[model samples]
Target: MSSASAQPANEPDNVFRDPAFRHFWFARLCTTIGYQILTVAVGWQMYALTNDAFMLGMVGLVQFLPSIVLLLMSGHVADRFDRRIIVRTCQMVEALIAVAMAVASFSGWITSEYIFLFVALLGGTRAFETPTLQALLPSVVTPRQLPRAVALASSATQAAIIIGPALGGFAYVAGPGVVYTISAVLFSIAALMVFTLKLRQAPQRLTAPVSVKTLFAGFAYIRSNPVLLGAISLDLFAVLLGGATALLPIYAKDILHTGPWGLGLLRSSPAIGALVTALWLARNPLNRRVGRVMFGAVAIFGVATMVFGISTWLPLSMAALVVLGASDMISVVVRSTLVQLDTPDDMRGRVGAVNSVFIGASNQLGEFESGVTAALLGPVGAVLLGGFGTLCVVAAWMKLFPMLTNRDQLHDHSAHGSGKAATAR
Candidate 1:
């Protein structure tokens, strides 16, 4: 699956022109939709079962725990193994989990306790699949088209996020079993699409022997590069502080006084905003002042979160979420471009794993934090506090990581032998 070998003779400028990327993109969309649906159904079911914010938080925590424990090993494996095989296997496992859950739901055997166990399984699959998929992306398209490819991928994900929850909400009218079954079918289709991809995975990196240092190479690489460290940390803390997703269920039920369908709409609003932004970026890619834009977008995200937190009007809250998503999309595109372009081919898997961990922590762990805070200070107070905290983070990040703030171009960095070079590796 070498790029040279897989590249079509008549390739066009657009990433969508690449057949391999088309299949990969479709695969990603299906899987993302399945995961989003599963998330909504599970979250709603957990809340209904226990009526406890903490338990809903626990759902996120359980899924994230496995990734934390296996983070280093997963990166190592992604670097060493055939990433396609790894991804395909994980998708199969996820499909099985979905099927099992569907059967359990139909049989009235599904419970909050078993759901935790199932979610843990999902987490384990994610631990390996995320890095492998991240590393695999570059293999699908040429380096010149990487930015557009990333944008397209982001758009696909946002589209799935927009559709999945709404579909899940409607499906729920029948039963959770139906939602789970649909998810399983989508996962199966995603797996098949992955199987069809023609990627040229890089040869496994074997420069160093297996050791603690080698296992944790991704962390070391990120830590040594102030720019990369700041970029990653900014996203880590900003999203952790600003994330309002975990509280959405509470908002849908208590605050907005909406039913399951309304909950679906609430969840989908951010994705709608994000999808539009992604499409815009795909056409007009960022070329300058990348760092400043990222910071500005994050600020906007925080403000939107605060607005959503206080608004009693459903339309206002939804609109705020739309802005939040749009702002976050800018940050995502900038950060992802910085990360992928900065790292060498050999280290993409490891660094990608580290990035995935940061993302999972910001999202999953943030959910847990929201739940705990909600229990203590009520959902409204918790969201408002998070929004304020996000603004403070932006101020701190600008000062602490002057290199990031000073960066002007996304693809102009020379990978310093250490990781801070002003040009791509």
Candidate 2:
């Protein structure tokens, strides 16, 4: 039997079967679900308290700003220390923040200001956690399976995105306080799961402590690598313009004319599409013409966003969002796999940190952009313009970053089992 045919149909044989990867995946899912639930609860609390659109925008800005500021330092810490320990510590901090939010909510002390503070704290943790997690994944799986592993991870996260908000909305109707308490419990459980994982320690460099020199080295690496720089920039610019998540409440309230339940569905539509695509990728890894596929997918995402912006019908908007989600997932998987496949192990943390900065900037900056645009042009105009802008970015990036367009030709150097190639600094 062929290798693919020999695999169990139910199992869909992939790198996910690795015990360590499975443990990591499950832990990630638990934390993500909790975080999503907390997000919805906080948004509900903020809306109930201030009822101001600008304040909502401010909440997102507060979180992203801190994350961008701290991301580089966090990456240095990840490289200088044991990544397993860093991840566990971050997870514990996340659990504590979740607990604190729950307590604040249950005690009738919840306010928009409090939510902002809490979110900022969580964002700080994420700045550290994201780099470490991204850097750590390759350690748990072989290079040949990196793409599959990434797809599985993305799918798991998207699954949480789909389920978490839906659950949060239902919980919110019961009470934001109750939702927060449940989120807290879930976070605690996720932390405990991280604590139980047996992770390999990254070799410590026999060099001076982390300093400005070390920080700049990461930047230098990015500046020197055209392919890496290109992939990162494509994602950064495209998502920075295309992301409309921050303005969803406006759409739900003004455009869709639905309440909290409708808002949840709108929030989840993309995740539903992403989850399905990720599962397919996990089962059938893409090994050919990945670059062309990525470009086409992102262009489709832009078109879908444009369609979504013009649609007033809830179902039609949701359909557009689904396409947007699926196309975005393709871009995400392609870019992420490229990063992992090319990065040296010693530099993974710093590189991942750089990626986090782009991610943080894109998401937070996107929120800021959406808020300002919506304030000036109204929500519909803002979304339509944003989508159109994303299409232009796609074209610009294709011309500017030829490496991304030729991504399929790139090889996974990490698969050769040569520690020298895999761990080169």
RMSD of each candidate relative to the true structure: 4.2, 3.8
lDDT of 2: 0.79
Q: What is the TM-score of each candidate against the true structure?
A: 0.87, 0.87
Q: Candidate 1: deviation at residue 390, Å?
A: 2.1
Q: Write the per-residue lDDT of candidate 2 for residues 365-425, one digit (tens) a residue.
A: 7877888898999988888888899889878878887766776733545332342342344
Clashes of 1: 11
Cα lDDT tens digits, model 1, 141-204, are: 7666777788888999999977888799889899999999999999899899999999744543
C-alpha displacement of 126 in model 1, angstroms?
1.2
Candidate 2, position 97, lDDT: 88
**Candidate 1 TM-score to native:** 0.87
Runs in model 2 lying further than 4 Å from the true structure: 1-12, 109-114, 199-208, 249-261, 374-380, 414-425
Least accurate 10 contiguous residues by lDDT in model 1: 416-425
